[model samples]
Target: MYLTSSRPDIVHTTCLCARYQAKPTENYLKEVKMIFCYLWGTINTGLWYTKDSGFELTGFSNAYYAGCKDTFKSTSDGAQFLGEKLVIWSSKKQDCTALSTAEA
Candidate 1:
């Protein structure tokens, strides 16, 4: 669970699995392993702090209409960075259903 602090990308997935930490089932364990595999595959993309880099903050975001097939809800995600390192990020389903793509 502590891994979520520095690895925002896996926060939601980790949190879901954490809910069953007391008596996790085989499915939950499989999910946890997948998370670790994902981390390993993206090892080089990790944030690294280094001296001499300028402290410039930047953010990017995107939303797609009806992106989630299961809920038919718009999904949005964002990432914030400080110089070369990511400081924050999030992905979530919107609360309201959109009437059209424009509304989403």
Candidate 2:
């Protein structure tokens, strides 16, 4: 959890890696160990909230057309924030086809 929260740069890679966790090979285990070592070496790394930034809330939504090769379904993505904190995010496959980005 800490690793996922702290390392946004690796989120995509980690998610791909996690798909193999149910049947992880030796290489996958090695990569997991490396991530653990990185976390152990940088345990102090995390968000440091402050009070005086005069922050505001903002959000964004994005989607891709026909992201699933097998089903040809679209994918939707969203991210919301309060100040500089990331409050919510999601990536999911859409149930219907999107004619355009707007439709998605």
Candidate 3:
């Protein structure tokens, strides 16, 4: 949870794993270890901000609809940026049958 602020790249995976924390299986354990291994391998990576760049606020979003398997729902992901820095991001399961970003 502490690393999410600094490591937006890993947030979605982390959250996905977290959803099964109440009843974690062997696969989840392996996935968690993989996340740790990935972090260790990229210990030197980080976002950098330059002083003279423009701070244009931009947002991007995408979503997918599978079917009526478990009610009408969609999986969506999005990121919002203030200038070049990420301000908000999320991967969500929403209660709608959305196929694309605009519909979601």
lDDT of each: 0.80, 0.68, 0.77
What value does the lDDT take at residue 40 in candidate 1? 95
Model 1: residues >4 Å from true position, as ranges?
9-33, 40-45
Best-matching candidate per TM-score: 3
Question: Which stretch of 10 consecutive residues in model 1 shows the poorest summed lDDT?
Answer: 11-20
Q: Candidate 2: where are CA atoms >4 Å away?
A: 1-45, 53-55
Q: Between 1 and 3, whose TM-score is larger?
A: 3
* Per-residue lDDT over 14-61 for candidate 1, one digit per residue giving the tens place of the 0 to 100 score: 755775689888998999999999999988776677887669999998
Could you tell me every candidate's TM-score relative to the true structure?
A: 0.60, 0.54, 0.75
Cα lDDT of model 3 by residue, 1-104, tens digit: 67877888897778667767998899989999999999999999987877765689999987666423445566677999888777788877676577654675
What is the Cα root-mean-square deviation between model 3 and the actual structure? 3.3
| Model with the higher lDDT, candidate 2 or 3 | 3
Positional deviation of residue 61's Cα in model 2 after best superposition, in angstroms: 0.8
| Backbone clashes under 3 angstroms, per model | 0, 0, 0
The lDDT, on a scale of 0 to 1, for candidate 3 is 0.77
**For candidate 3, what is the TM-score?**
0.75
In the range 6-97, model 2's lDDT, one tens digit per residue, is 55544544654575678888988888888778778877776666666436889988777776655666777677777877766665678788
